[model samples]
Target: MVSTIVWGTGNIGRAAIRAVAAHPALKLTAVLVNDPAKAGRDAGELAGLGRRLGVAASTDVEAALAAAPRAVVYAASGDLRPAEALADVVRAIRAGAVVVTPSLYALYDRRGAPPEASEPVLAAIEAGGGSLFASGVDPGWANDVLPLLVSGLATTMDAVRCQEIFDYTTYDQPDVVRYLVGMGQPMDYRPPMLAPTVPSMVWGGQIRLMARALGVELDELRESVARRPLDDTVTTAAMGVFESGTQGAVRFEVLGIVGGLPRIVIEHVTRIHPSCAPDWPQPHSGAGSHRVIVEGRPRIEVTVEATDEDGNRAAGGNATAVGRLVGAIDWLVEARPGLYDALDVPLRPAIGRLGRRGV
Candidate 1:
């Protein structure tokens, strides 16, 4: 069994805990949290599993690493504090633990990743003989794996597009929705996500990944953004009132131009309230989905809708991303130590998980 440590107890961490418990080959060895309030709590309870997992969460990062777990689920939020997140993963890698995370966006495409992000991580892997893979749902599977997988179905292709159609009303991340994404903020309040070149900085790698897989080089990368203000005020159960005229919806794309056209695209249509952008892309029938569209001879379109716990798509998406990460731990344990991208890892199936149950 691969002894694993879950390094965060937030949204992603909650799912990581349950995933580790359910996987036949993974033993839940430790849960590390920076939150003092969460320290010493049972992993299962923190994961909302309705039972104690015996393994308690700890505030001690050093102590957890000292045990030298075979795998580390680095689920800490890297949205704001990316440097610190990279450092944490580096520390874990240098400890000889195979690390998987959704934290490092820059390294999603190792070849296209900036030298600053890729160089240090490579050094860490060389020093410790441990591997690292950075992926999640949007930047994870939907961005690279799902789109590229579907591209194989096309006889001939003109363009490939990946879309995230999500309604964040039920999503509990207010700081992300309000501050980071500028959902309820004024139109002038530009969030870090939509800042010039930031979208390209964040999602441009996925486009390059697809291009590389197709054995073609991108001519250039571009970003386009559009935002809409609410026609009226709205109230959400999770985040309280959002005044009218604030930013309500956003549609943006990171385009990978090949030859002379925008051939590869990653688009997102995110709404704080459904009424804001009636014309923009909506989820198939629910709050969220990852959709792929290939404009080719056959014209293929596929959508992924995932739900977890109480039918929450956001949580479900996170769970699926965790599945991709946790599901690969066993493979990483035996593979040569190095940095890897989604394309380097196979989406292994539930070989022994047919009857698995969480504690």
Candidate 2:
């Protein structure tokens, strides 16, 4: 079995723990947590898996990596601390452990990634002869593999649009929703996510990766953004309350233009309250969806609605992201040491372990 360590115990990290434990070929080793209070806890309990895996959580990064884990699932949040996240990933790579993460947004597509972000990671892999793969749901399977697969059926193509339309009220990440996304901030406040060039910085790689898959070069990359304020105060199960006229919803698109038209587009329509943007598209089910629209000969549209154990759609999305990273572990171990993204790594299908119930 491939020995694995789950680094971080946040949203994606907890999901990674469950995925690692359920995979037949992967064994859950030590879990690394930054919180000292969480140290020495059972991995299963931390992940809400209902049983102990015999591996305990630890605060020592070196000690965990010293155990010679074959792969490290780095699930820590990089939205706010990208440099720190990049450093952590490099440290793991340099320790001779294959690292897969959704933390490093810039390295999602190494070819288009900034030199500063990709260079150090490449250096670390070279130093330790370990591989690295980074990806998540939107920047991952939904845009890269899924669209390419659907485009094959088209006799001719017009444009490709990948959309993540979700209500953030149930997402429950206060820091991300209130501050990073500017969900409950004042109207004049600018969320770091929708800031100038930030959308492109985060999702341009996805557009370029799809362009590569389709064998087309984009003429340019562009971004369009719009924000909506709440009409009245609203409360949610997770995020406490959002007041009237605050930045309640945001809609943005990262477009890859070809021939002066948006040929490849990635869109996000996030809302703190469902009533905020009645005009914008919404998920067909509980909270939200990931949609792929191919405007062409066949005109294909695929909408995905996923739910977690608690029936939260956003948590469900996070789980799939964990699956994408953890699923690539064995493949990364076999692959030559280097940085890999969605294009370099193949899509791993869901074949849950035979004896694992409700995986």
Supply the TM-score for candidate 2: 0.97
State the displacement of the C-alpha of residue 203, model 1, in Å, after optimal TM-score superposition.
Answer: 0.8
Best-fitting candidate, scored by lDDT:
1
lDDT of 1 by residue, 22-139 (tens): 9999999999999899988999999999998899999898999999999999999999999999999999999999999998889888988999899989999989988999885463
Clashing pairs in 1: none
Alpha-carbon error at 8 in model 2, in Å? 0.6
Worst 10 residues of 2 by lDDT: 350-359
Local distance difference test scores for all models: 0.90, 0.88
Give me the displacement of residue 336 in model 1, in angstroms.
Answer: 0.4
Write candidate 2's Cα lDDT for 2-101 as tens digits. 9999999988888899999888778888899999999999988899888888888999998888888889999888999999999999999998999999
Which residue pairs in model 2 clash with each other? none
**Cand. 2 Cα-lDDT:** 0.88
Model 2 Cα RMSD, 1 decimal:
1.2
> Each model's TM-score, in the order given?
0.98, 0.97
